[model samples]
Target: MLRAAMTGAIAAAIAVALAGCGAAPSNSGEGEGPVRVTTTIGQITDIVTNIGGERVEVAGIMPSGVDPHLYKATQGDIAKFEDADIVFYNGLHLEGKMTEVFEEMAEHKPTIAVGESIDPASLIEVANADGTQVYDPHIWFDVKLWMQAAETVQRELAKLDPDNAGTYEANAKAYLAELEALDAYARERIATIPEGQRVLVTAHDAFGYFGKAYDIEVRGLQGISTASEAGSKDVTDLRDFLVERKIKAVFVETSVSNRSITAVIEGAKKLGHDLKEGGTLYSDAMGEEGTPEGTYVGMVRHNVDTIVNALQ
Candidate 1:
């Protein structure tokens, strides 16, 4: 599908156009100017924009509410990659289908894997039935961890366009400060929920980092990646668990279908527990471009407030 989406003319243009990368914009007067940054997901796009500020022209592949795990790049997306001076994406197979596209682009330009900066020991590893473990790619849920990603962005931007190094530095410092406050807010607000009622049930386990960082027990009907389906047994198991614990709500995600979650809710009702839909949480994706939930900090803030208001 990827090749089909960007075949013949687009593929032929990549090699020729890539030779022109890292050049200043047409109007920038002969020096390294604004970096043409193309990112795979909106979370990474938000980070690049915040850290790079006015120094980057970012084109994000997967927009708000698009699931990166299931996203397949289009012809236009391929063109964005070709035009970019640098490409940034969440690693650990988050953008699974785009792996080949990233590989092809990295050979020509400064393609960065954002998750590389994070410590492996700190990652949440989900074990498959075959006994292999894949590290969770939803690192943006932990504000502190996400801050590291922002730092990575600024560091790379400084390297790519040295003339604007100071600007990137200043922007990163300010953004990191806001992230610190956001992290504290998450910890404190989640702490406000009654210990027993603090359980967060969502359709997918994208919030492992959030739950771990905030000291809440998180249960998901599905696994880490939304690519996996929530089976009937999964629903029954979660339903019984919710009924046993009397969990008041289970949240749905903006990027994922809520059918499994709805099933869980209905099943809980049949078992005599009136479980409510807490609210929609931003999981693998965010809200629209101009909305509060569009940016990383805004998305995190919204999720924290929603969880706290629902459970506390």
Candidate 2:
């Protein structure tokens, strides 16, 4: 029902947005100062901004603190796609309702799913609400995995604008170095927390990659997608896990409701376990534009610092 409603809205808006828009721009990268790139999700937008550098104009479809799992593309978003030289998004159903929009745009321009470009073996498999298996879409939590996404963006940008391939390469190399440093920082900081206290619980299972990369245990009240509501059983189970494990903190996501987390916390309290509300996490979304947490590196830094400080 949620997906259907979002899709209907998107289809209507897109039709109106493209009413008189002529053929899609050829995007040959000739006779242009910079290629216009449209992307969904702040993570991908940041990647394009860094890798494309001065050679691309980047715009994001989803704003900071917006849940991509439930984001319905607007007419303005359709206009952005129609005017772009390329579009990039995190696939594996990250932009659940926007999948068709991306597909339609792909026929007109280079539409790359940077997250899906990563190796299958590297992805975490989980059962969907219906019990079918799918790879988790929140790949940015793992800095190393996101580095791969950066590389994918660099490669595609080079393909799209060979004239600026050198520029993209140089920019990507620099950005990658920063990400490497960020990854090391996450590893070092996460190591400071005792193994027993390294557990991270969030509103949703958006940190599985982060847990695997940093050797911490991760739990979420809801499933991979926020569309999958947390049932009373889920809250009870998580509550018990926290109490039994003596977990100290539960984190809320900027894009997800804190109601479930609150329920889990109250349940744990009733069982005589005091749980702290760890600072907000930028799961499934980034921070406000221009803020430190708005960028991918800053967002990861914020999350790692928050988790370590809380659980330490």
Candidate 3:
């Protein structure tokens, strides 16, 4: 979830944590060797870097495990945007606070919103309690949709650097095939769980697409946006659902805090259900660099393994 509603105290703590850490300004030096590109998140960066190879220098604005919804651009990030030959963002307002900034930068450079290029009808829209639809920006949760997004990025990158079009297309095709295999693997792994226990309760509502793809029932403590508060009603409602279903485990996200999930555990305990920590699931962001879940494919595989081990 891109949006995070932080209390004043929490906001202050975050600010203090970020204080005095300076990132490099945008890369400069006009004499072109490799084209410079900027990505809003690590997933985009990884794909771009993979396809571009050594022909492009790519920088990711949001680090691994950082929440995109609440990410604020710093002075260093502005420089990176200004210097890039192309910019890639997840789109559908995933970079909630940075949307306006990216829009402004798009006027000066080639900017691609990968998610927006995918057909809207193909996307799964989230609904409010009254059933009104909002675009679910977490399309990467579904491997099929993510492959589409990767193609979109490949097309844009090829357009920007036509000299390397063949390489980009080939890499995209290979990566897409890997993504397809990953989807098959996830389906098989998830099938090992009892049919009735295919319920997935997580820290936030980021897994609607995952549920749709894998035939699992997904529930979350918070709404689509971490910006929203997890009220008493939300906790109570989830607690009742867990108890009714006799769910044994639930998940915590990589980027989001575990406070709300802890509340669910407590609620389940009071209701006589012996719930356990299912394991940490990578939700909003991938794992740390060089880890098994650092790349897109690795992240999905790790998620499947964690879910299967917990539920089986």
Candidate 4:
């Protein structure tokens, strides 16, 4: 079993990591130019960059292929956060490891949790180890929910840089429209997969929101947080499920290890179900900077295209 990872030591550990990194720049001084924005993940970074355009200097703490669930902040990241005019993060524990740092910074900065801005009623509940409920934080998988996040970014950007409020609003309007079109594309492509084969199996439960939005059944060997372990029973059960349902493919995430999914495939193969590896999905991280999967919209399109092609 994985250790209960979210102890008080998390913040203290991060503080220690940032201690040696000398003084960081401040946003308080007069004659500030472009808005210095720091985002916790690439997806959030993409949105802020699109909405802020040439007016904001955006830095993403977690780079491509880094798993946010277990990401630890370095001294340079601390400096970036400290110097940022505004900070945006996906809340509801998606950045579980960085929650403490974000909470502390929220006290004095324009730090915003874009995920928290979504209507709680629309958020999907996941059970924790203590049987308590927590919302799934992978809202970006659902294009519509991501649109909400973009709106929140727009609101925060306007608040932080009122001088460019109109520009931010206009950019947000255009991006939101693009997101609407992306949502339609996802739905259409997903519908192409035969209804019975629409089930999505990933390494973890990150795709719950995506499944809900796209009308597919999603299963994972591990729970919502990757910090949790997939026990033998869980693996066996998933293996049996795949074999029984004749699931054609199972996916690996770009940021997450594929060991669990591989186990499922081996288990199913032993039972005479030959499953294939579906192309990797950008779950916690987007693709490299220059690729289509690097941007949020491009990532979504890539995912839908991969899934439809694999399962069709």
Candidate 5:
């Protein structure tokens, strides 16, 4: 019912915005300047900005530390979408609240779902509450998977701006090679944390792909979507798992509240186990702009360094 109401509101808002949009701008007169590209998350924004180089002007609606799962589109965001020459987002419902907006805008623009291009078989399938399987949208957590996303962005950009096709391709190739190096670095660094200390407990299930790629055990207090609550049972179960394994640290997420993880910590303490916040992980969003974690590669590196240092 809540989802229905939110959807209704977004639909009405989009309708009004479109109604007031007046005449559509001439597609041919888009001008000989930077291709205005609007992306959903900072990770996408960073890659697009890098790959687009001087050919595209990239902007993201969701800022650092903003939870994408529950982010609702506003009038300003709708205007951004309307003005953009191209739009890119991490699909598979990562931006659950903005699905309608994306669908509506894709009608006339090159709105691309970067994550959807990856082969479905390569995606992690998890059962939903209603017993339906869905692909995990946190593909960016795995550097290799994110390479696929980078390629998708390049393809779309090249298609939209054919004159700059060579540049986009070259940039994508360079970025992909960097991603390969990042993947190798993650594996090497994570392997140094003794086998028994490979467990990564966090606020939510955002690190599944990360764990799968690096051979670590990941457990989270809440589900993949932060919209779901972590009940007492969930916290108790995680606390018991921490106590039984004697895990010393659990990480908090940038986009999620620390309360749930804190509860698990207190629960573990009550059961004669001591735990601390391992570190803050960038789950749904990256770090602040102008910082190292602001970029995707840097974000992944920071997470790996934090986890390895804490768990080791």
Candidate 6:
């Protein structure tokens, strides 16, 4: 009896995984008819859904907390991409692994890389340890940049669905105000952490804009992409830095595994520095669908709250 129950549970788990492998249905309003759209990240999905409201149906190719850099779309995801009226992505090499697929989709659909619309000068470029500069593609970390991205989405949505232009504009404006408020809240909360402890170390290099906006020093074990493996030297350097600076905590990312971070902690301990576990931070993606961190605004707020509470 137990064996039969275990087999059934395993089969059910496989079914759920297979289901999630495909694209989710459009969240369009009743009787509105299908107007397909696909987003790269859940945050963008939320923005599109908010402005599009009942007039449009939106689906995200990448699930919450999935690393966009390493996401591999299945056969079902490709089907959704082919059928989308518009494809919205946070370009600037963010969709590292899926860029080729999006490019191919652009041949057939009105795919938009929203981040590309932002002024290049406003973004901060990252450098390798050897000092060659690379563009930081995680612009959504900064509320200001995210608001700009949202506006771009609003414009594109308006262009596609002229009848709902007014609705989109109003929704975008309200959402932008919320983003502004979140920026203010982050600033106030982050100020509580002492200047000396304002260092943020995470699993990957996704918080350049967050560090710049909030005056925190950011460090990541891995590069911009989780696809890249961290070297022993990279771990050693971070371990030494944490010990030398006496940083109290280092954070774990929600999307990435904690192996690298745990290694860093152990290395630090061996060097006579004990580091605490800073709370889990939302990096490559937001929280689950219903929680406070599920929405874009809530995601940023939750990050700020977690960082402040842990570091301060």
The digit string of per-residue lDDT tens for model 6 on 1-312 reads 001012334334434543454354432333357567888898889889877777777888787778877665665675566557788998877776566565555654577888898999988877643456767888989989988998998898777677667888999888888888999999889989999999999998889999999889999988876767788999999999999999999999889999989999999988889898888999989899888888888898889998998888
* TM-scores for the candidates: 0.91, 0.95, 0.88, 0.92, 0.94, 0.87
lDDT of model 4 at position 199: 93
lDDT of 4 by residue, 94-179 (tens): 88767778767765567799999999999999886557788888999999999999999999888877778898999999999999
Worst 10 residues of 5 by lDDT: 22-31
The segments of candidate 6 whose C-alpha lies over 4 angstroms from its true place after superposition are 1-34, 128-132
lDDT of 4: 0.85
What do the candidate models score in CA lDDT, each in turn?
0.83, 0.86, 0.79, 0.85, 0.85, 0.80
lDDT of residue 21 for candidate 6: 40
Arranged by TM-score, best first: 2, 5, 4, 1, 3, 6
Top model by lDDT, which number? 2
Ranking by lDDT: 2, 4, 5, 1, 6, 3
Worst 10 residues of 3 by lDDT: 20-29
TM-score of 6: 0.87
Give the lDDT of residue 190 in candidate 2: 98
Task: Name the top TM-score candidate.
Answer: 2
Tens-place lDDT per residue, model 3, 160-251, is 67777887888988888888899999888898899889989998899999999998889998877676668888989998899999888999
- Residue pairs with colliding backbones in model 2 are none
TM-score of 4: 0.92
Question: What is the Cα-based TM-score of model 1?
Answer: 0.91
The TM-score of predicted model 3 comes to 0.88
What TM-score does structure 2 among the candidates reach?
0.95
Please report how far candidate 4 places residue 125 from its true position, in Å. Answer: 0.4
Please provide, for model 2 over 1-312, each residue's C-alpha lDDT reduced to its tens digit, 9 standing for 90 to 100.
124235667766665554444465545468556888889999999999999888888989899889998888877788787788788999999888877777666655678999889999999999888888889988988999999999999999889888778999999999999999999999999999999998999988889999999999999888898888988999999999899989999999899999999998888888899998988988888999999999998899999999999999
How far in Å is the alpha carbon of 206 misplaced in model 6? 0.8
